[model samples]
Target: MQHLETMPRGLPKAVKKCLEKSRDSALLAVETYNKPAIKFKSGGYIVLMVISWTALFHAIFFRQKKKPFYKKNNRFEKKDGDYCYWELSTCVSKYFVADTNNPIRKNLEFFIPLRNMVEHKSIPEIDSDIFAECQAMLLNYDKIMLKEFGNKYCLRESLSFALQLYPSSKSLNNAIIANPSTKPIVDFIKAYRSGITTDIMNSGEYSFKAFLIQVANHQTKNTLPIQFVAYDKLDDTQKTNVNRVAALVKNKFVQVPVTNKDLLKPSVVVKKVQTALGNPKINKNGKEKDKFNMDTHTRCWKKYQVRPENGNENPELTKPEYCVYDQPNDTYLYTEDWSDYLIEEMAKEDEYNSLYE
Candidate 1:
């Protein structure tokens, strides 16, 4: 085994360590993803990729601001212990200006959930379906690395596309379609693709698009293979063809927009939570009170500490509103996101009861 040590000679120790760790995680993610024989390599890739991004942001925070990236919590206090810092997602969401729309955020949305799923169970051989995302992950990593550090430390030249044994796209598609084992993987890809915006789905920057076309012979020995022409760079005829293909694909996987208007009433939110918990109702003060009822939701509003009840008094309490209260209507309008959160939490409670109660 090769001897290894972190050398924080010239740079700040935290910054150096974070950068090194990020690069190591990214390289390992790519390597694990490429090895087809590796079981659940996708999970390894996603976990490491997320760690890489988290560490990257940590390094950036230290390098730019010259302070520790983590935040302190009074709960974890000890005489000699250090304060806890934010995780990658929290750091990015809290500090990063690219929260609205960026390749890094877009890529993370997919990989983070994937990391969660794969942590619970093994994912079958379906990495090829998300080839674009995997490719973009590395690309975005290098882009950020170059921007944060410099061209001297860029890893672009060190990496290349993983060579596949079977280049037949038709055969691969057919196999995925026919195989029972791959059904969940296909469904996941389609569902994920359909949820995003048209531009995001098509953006090569967000997810690198590569069309595998068969070629008979090379034009020249010196001329490099694997030509990638952007949609804007294409000629009129080529652009028309690309548009047609995009339309066809879009039609098949219709995009479902997730808007705030899909928000649920407090009653709906209560019903969902109650149903998820499988709790019918309980007698309370000569009236039926659901175990996961409006009161429960009210408690959740206080517990989760996201939606502010007194937005009118202290608007700062609802800085980022997940639920809006309509004073005129005298009702709380909880977002679909809030409803989902409640349901997930309720389900977890139910599972805990079933397991331990």
Candidate 2:
């Protein structure tokens, strides 16, 4: 509960400013998120948290870089003229020694796509659906903040439990049914969660697990207001039996809808692009060749960085959200959305110059 009433004089000014901003933004985010009056705008809370966390990382990177923190062509910069100091995603990759499965990274991945989707659109169910992840995000922030700065700078005490609104199976079910417009959000959440491993999904650091308890009113003021009894607080049998409570929340959401017919193979993707682009041809190595061939499609995929790299063996890659990998057939699966993206990107070059003219 140490208060940073004033910026310590000895520390670098940039580091101080960045850390201060980060702390402020984090507090604002949690405050905004928990306030029911502005529940509709709670998605903005994630954006703020991202900004705050990004700044905190930048401060760390800057401190680690020390004297040359502002020097040109450092790891934080792309070129002499191009700087990536303020970019969150780039900073995470450069500073944090984390993998794709890291809890912080995983949580960020969930939020990043979500933030993109709900940027302008008022997705009503986002706050309710992402409750666990949002709780974990704040918890992670405080832990990392303490680890990075020190216990003195941690904000754990400032954050309290976000009391459950409806903490029973029937209530939760009714809430889901009443909010039918959230179907798309529910589908996206399921598709994304389905792609992640069970360990990651079940990890409290990745997504906080809340077990609803009906507490009796305390007449004595000396009784604890709210207590966080960790797993260790429970005996071995209780620990093993906790699965019963977890089952209450597990697989309760709508499963991702299966659309088995729309998937297309690489050859089909190429053919579709070629037909859409007027079946044009280009001069290859001493010979004229179809411009929209498999090679061309491969080049396009790499250029645009279509995620879940083609032919990746990761089981999650075949989830049919972005693309699916057929195990037995040994082929990559793509959808109509991917086809449209390819055609749209290829059309910009417009190999058939006559059409633009």
Best by TM-score: 2
lDDT of 1 by residue, 1-357 (tens): 001153425557777778878878888888887887887766788888889888888888887764543434625433446646667666667555655566567676667656666675565455555666877887788888788877745566667767877532332344366565654444445445544556877787668865554677787798667666667789999999887876775566444223234446677788877776677676779997776776677777776776566545753344134665433223455666787777777667564334323
Candidate 1 lowest-lDDT run of ten: 1-10
List residue ranges in candidate 1 displaced over 4 A.
1-10, 66-69, 72-83, 167-194, 235-237, 241-357
lDDT of 2 at 354: 30
Error of 2 at 300 (Å): 24
Lowest lDDT sum, 10 consecutive residues, model 2, at 167-176
**Model 1: lDDT to the true structure:** 0.65
TM-scores across all candidates?
0.58, 0.62
Tens digit of per-residue lDDT, candidate 2, span 282-338:
886899888778877766655555545645556444434546554323445677888
After TM-score superposition, the amount by which residue 59's alpha carbon in candidate 2 deviates from its true location, in angstroms, is: 1.5
Provide the lDDT at 332 for model 1: 50
Give candidates' CA RMSD values in order: 13.3, 12.0
